[model samples]
Target: MRGFLASSIGVTCAAALALPLTLPSSGARAVTPATQSPAQRSAESVPGSTQSLPLISFGSDRSQGGGASREQGLHQREVKPFSLVGVIWDNPDDELNGSVQVRTRASGTGTWTAWQPVETHNHEHAADPDAEERASGRIRGSTAPLWVGDSDGVEIRVRGEAAEQRSDPALHRGEAAQHSGDAVEHRASAGSPAAAGQALPAGLRLELVDPGAEPPPQGSRPKGAPEALTAETAAASAVNADLAPLGADAIPPLSKKKTESDLIAARGGPEEAAGKARPYVGPRPRIITRKGWGANEKLREKKFAYTRTVKAAFVHHSASGNNYRCSQAGSVLRSIYRYHVKSSGWRDFGYNFAVDKCGNIYEGRAGGVAKPVLGAHTLGFNTNSTGIAVLGSFGYSNPPAAAVNAIARLTAWKLGLYGANPRGSTYLRSGGGNLYTKGKNVRLHVISGHRDGFATECPGIRLYKKLGKARSTSARLQGR
Candidate 1:
């Protein structure tokens, strides 16, 4: 393990890009079953080529032995132009509060983009918020990674609020209260002691990811290829090939379903419909399972919760820049998974499902894909709504057609299970947030953008614009 040393370490660019990696590619990033060697698949994969940077601690401990821990920042460094970055804290216990944010500059002299906040409250996004796996000595708490586009020079700062824990007496009072059931619940919900005192974080880390150049094309091994090349590698390549970047056509839409109203009308009004039953369009969409995306379920604590039925599908954009290749989608998902649970302090991945740019769909949030698994995507609306985040930022970039269709198909199938109309509206009682303050019943389109229910510019302007289409297509697919 690296010591908690606050210093800059220069690393070779090659070494930084060499971690075991993966990103899957297939038709529309879809996987076609095939025999393959895991090693070969592993070689061609890995997302967000990264380098970890140490942070300098700040603040003077006010209360006990060494006072409260202070914050940390990274010295500016020159790196390969890249899009995504993340921050990590050395301590997992409740010692850090505040947030982690960063800014970057173009390596060739372009100006720096505004400092962006890395999501810190992502614990709710994990399958298990308090999983002991999160306490792994090999890992530390981290910030939800952000997509920054291509930038070379980067600087990071992790400042936290230390107001409440300034004195040991006050801090001790908190410790004394830890045994009460109320305190236990409080600790369970808000584990960050840093947040309790309103103090900044200390012993921090910054992670930079460069998706890197595309992999070498795979073809039959040369006659004189090294002995290391084997038939298993060929099989692996075939299995992983689907993960390659694909056009929108790779993922075909399911046949349309007849609308509930259309069915009623077709049966000659409510009187006739009362004696008839609805038709099943088909089985649910083929969800790329957690195993398909290589999620480590053991990393999560085993607890489950549920809402009755999902009433809405809130769209979102990953914001982690479009720096990834479709093949690298697996790695990207894993990074977000670990970051959400370990860094953000969420229960599981915030979304119920996720779509890659190539249009491949993956199950998220541990619960059954068709269940009303409450999420943390839209602050006041997670309970009855499913969150589906596209894998890349789309504020300015045009979201791929395949991704949009994937959302429609997913919602159509999932919502159809609950008999929800894609081209309709539903009311979700607000838990709390700017869009629907606590207890307010917010009515939203079945397929709404994250921005519709929250103040965030989530789902991005470009992607948000596509929700309308996704809704229509999803409805059509449901036979409406």
Candidate 2:
């Protein structure tokens, strides 16, 4: 993802006179899906609920144009319940170029929608460092996943091409034209409307995750997990039947305790605190930790590291698919955590925190939710910023109001912790990348979309439009 000054297109929502004014609640009910009461397992794990569907690797890996790379895979002729779709491919050197096209049987009509394009310019959307461990394995590149609603039948074709071969006119005029068009379309896709129909790509392994058929009963959790529910988790996972927006404060605040910089903060005291960076506000959002989601911490090469101050919040949409229930949010984080570390070859998951469609916020890439745990998100701007990834791709689809409000709430507390206004401006020295050359001091809004820093279509155009709302709401929450 390239970063900086790529103006965001604004989105407006008009409130009709007939409609009542809606305000976010000061608090929300949370859910603790950590333990599945037997009843939940029995109720949710019904006749046909959870199942793994694998992608069929097509033609063998072959060299295209001398030493160029190309790979393909296919998934067809099967029926299974699933909400999300993703593509994974081995690209250790980050030289693989690929595309995917998919059509799913619509849950409503049982008919398939036209093949839609799953934005594939996800190459720059990561902090792909040249680490030794990363070079030694089956590292891969993936398209930002697509949400195809509830679908029983799906078809996918993936194709990968070498980076250098992108400009090879000798390959074929059609191929040349395709690359040319790709560049043009990508440049103009900023908050652009989705085309009536689009075709996916081929080249990587595809994954489909099912969120189960029904949500578990509240507090009616199965036995053995625990005899009680915390005010935090219970509220974070509550589902809104009407899909109304909730307050950013829906997530409970974290416990006040020693954080990653405890010793440093202690040494500084009140006088020192006043001299150094601005601290955030009290009553932080309850962030679901890596341990909470069962992370294999040892899988990473090193322990956590910290940046200076969190001057800005870069909003991003986790390239993962959008088909998820608040209950399955745990599974989504676990899979992404493993994939980011073991599969994508990063130290940990990229985003600092992840927000599900149902509005549950999960803590990501642990250091200290309160600490500036530098993440791999937004490439050049990782330092001095906290990345909040709303789970699911929002490129073509409109994000739920609940998700939007969650971003506001998380940012409201996190950004306020540093005594920064959610809607203010801050400057960060670029670490150097495609968007702004390294070392360039970039001025940005306190709350910015990922594309604002990177050239890639991150945080997605649809989600980008809501940044304005998030900023305003977050600022208001902070008493602006």
Candidate 3:
């Protein structure tokens, strides 16, 4: 009853059917067919003996080169001398599930080997009692070694029901049929060590391999995932689409309005023709006077005389209270002076003059001197420009119409005295050059905000927008 199964290696035991067997007394036993069941008879005829019933052997007279092999009952096979190895289980019934252990030996003549475990389970019944049932059923599981050296090979072993029993009527009859799952193939390859250490160079060749099937769906994206849409990218894409139609060099020019004549034409003629002009104005700037020359008599008595004329003007806001009433405005000015002198430790008020919402001006720091006083307003320009403190904060509130008018008239008066023309536009601190010359001898009139001179947003965006209008009005008043 004994028979031999031919394999790539050599002759191995063949399963017996409807037969008996008798064991031989020497060398490898070949069981007699009459005395044993076909299964038992086939077991004895195997080269490695029944104890090693399922054995993996290298081909006869083949030089596998220092390879190793092991047989463990019907459940395990071990192979060596190979570096990259993996197992493939060809389950016809398709019920494959289990934990797998993989071991590998590094390259070189070194013996430091490591083992890691990976588990695979059926996604549908993973959490139920059926998991264990499926593990013990007709399903077959196998493990194969993965090697990573010059030569790669694997040794595979199977567990659970033997392949011969797969066709037994007793195992399948009268039982609910189970569908065979898809075949599971596990593979590993020896990757280049250099590839793992650094990024591949640009223009490297790559092969695109198609993944066979789709996996089951998972839930929503996790929190804190990056946004897929970006404004810059979207805008760039739109610009690219537009460029395809326009042939490049289609970028528009910069001017929003052509000129003053063009703006006037759009508005339908001059203000005088349209009867929208207001009455011609005369100078009505408020001025305060005090009769004092050098240091006071008290300072003379104390033997210290300091005489300094007002050479520059500084501008600021009260930043407290609205509409600049005389009493409240005066008090705010006093508080500012005290804060500057006591807290900031300055000589006197930071400004030489202050203007209220009522168009009233108050004398401060310097009183009745005709000379221009130096003030702390426009950083470098403060050496020459006079400081004028307007009564209320203009950051949020619009400058009152009266206040704007007064600023224009006052600037005109100052321009006349300084022999400067308000027509030319000069950036603050553009010293000495005749930025605007009426004939050929006029001086430059510089007007700008705190931020323009230094680096602060004191006058605020709302108020700073008025500078252009103020300049135009001042120029007209100065007969520029």
Candidate 4:
């Protein structure tokens, strides 16, 4: 166990130097195929990519009842082929008191789909107001991204509520406080009386994501052929080496007895190492590593931040909608990752892990999957908790049984690592949110829904209703 820790630490140090702060230009940038043999080239699949475009006002708004009720959007236009779409604005603290809708033309059919509403209440799925990440001044307000399948043309509309009028500063505390220059410029340009009623925040842009291509599956290389490793990929994969070989697609599950033995070894106390005390850890479940999903390692910040311990698990729905196939889960993940970092200004993917509709689990965010990695999810409750996002909107759609079962298996293993009971309750001091104020000690379920910690509707009603099953199953797996 000690040797495992030693090697992990060594590799982490060696790879840390290659961590990046900036993102690559808008496209997948994997190692050039020309530099590798045919086998290596085949192993390197096409990378995922994202394109960001700014949104412009539609036309004169006087024709739409009240003159103040204006709309911002793009008329029917062709763009690079993309499968997902969302909108973002400057100032993470601002609220979009409005409706956002989009319609897309199918990639090859030339037929356009009916306009769909994008989830607008997305502020609650973010870093707490006081975290260093929020203070970094890069965060942006975003609408939940929607999957549109493969599309080549699109149209969108964003119409703000016409009832209220307030100064731009009052619209966003963070922008007024930290980015006053940008705010002042916005206010000055939209100074007309009509614009004051429902003016949108500045720097609003549309994000079109092409979740590039899936990575080649494991064992695709010729027998005994060596695997290629970029420094970024190595850094992302090294943290999980304790559970799987470097660059492995997934961590193989362990038997209950093996899990207990490994848990004892990891604790490293003489008494615990002797296996005199029974550990309440569950058998590890298979988890797809970041490499398996074709994550652009260069798209995130270098260093990882962690809390002291994980006391709770917060579950969420991607809210990107349910228009994707299980085979495209990796592509969806890569798109979300790019959207989080490149489009929304987050340091990395917000959740600790993600589960596809088919129940396949994929690693989210960098850092060791076993560690207490701090995530920009479940605002006011990120500390001492891990976040898991089920990949789809579940508000109107019933969650798949396989997906719910996968959540149980995941929390059983991960929560057990910190001695947390999946069915029990715990207290987490709020870092500040709509439901709880800063420093408030709140009692919550160990396995809670995203809405339990924030005021937004997330993890949706259908998925949230199944928490009872997840908790019971998780406890049973832990042999409680």
Candidate closest to the true structure, highest TM-score: 4
Ranking of predictions according to lDDT: 4, 1, 2, 3
User: What order do candidates take by TM-score, descending?
Assistant: 4, 2, 1, 3
Question: What's the lDDT for residue 242 in model 1?
Answer: 29
Runs of candidate 1 exceeding 4 Å displacement:
1-54, 57-72, 76-84, 88-143, 147-275, 280-283
- What is the C-alpha local distance difference test score of each model? 0.56, 0.56, 0.31, 0.76
TM-score of 1: 0.56
- Candidate 2 has an lDDT of 0.56
What's each prediction's TM-score?
A: 0.56, 0.61, 0.33, 0.84
Please state every model's RMSD to the true fold in angstroms.
13.5, 13.1, 47.4, 8.8
Tell me the tens digit of each residue's lDDT in model 4 across 144-219.
Answer: 8888888999999988765354333224222121211212121223343333444566667889998886677888
Model 3: residues >4 Å from true position, as ranges? 1-284, 289-315, 321-324, 367-369, 426-445
What's the number of clashes in each of the models? 59, 43, 29, 1
Per-residue lDDT over 318-419 for candidate 2, one digit per residue giving the tens place of the 0 to 100 score: 866666677667666666665565545566677888898977777776444555656778867887888998988876799999999989878877776566
Query: Is 2 or 4 the stronger prediction by lDDT?
Result: 4
Candidate 2 lands at a TM-score of: 0.61
Q: What root-mean-square deviation over C-alphas does model 3 reach? A: 47.4
lDDT of 3 by residue, 314-416 (tens): 2455443253345344334544443333222233444555667766555444311122434433433443455566666666687776665656656554443
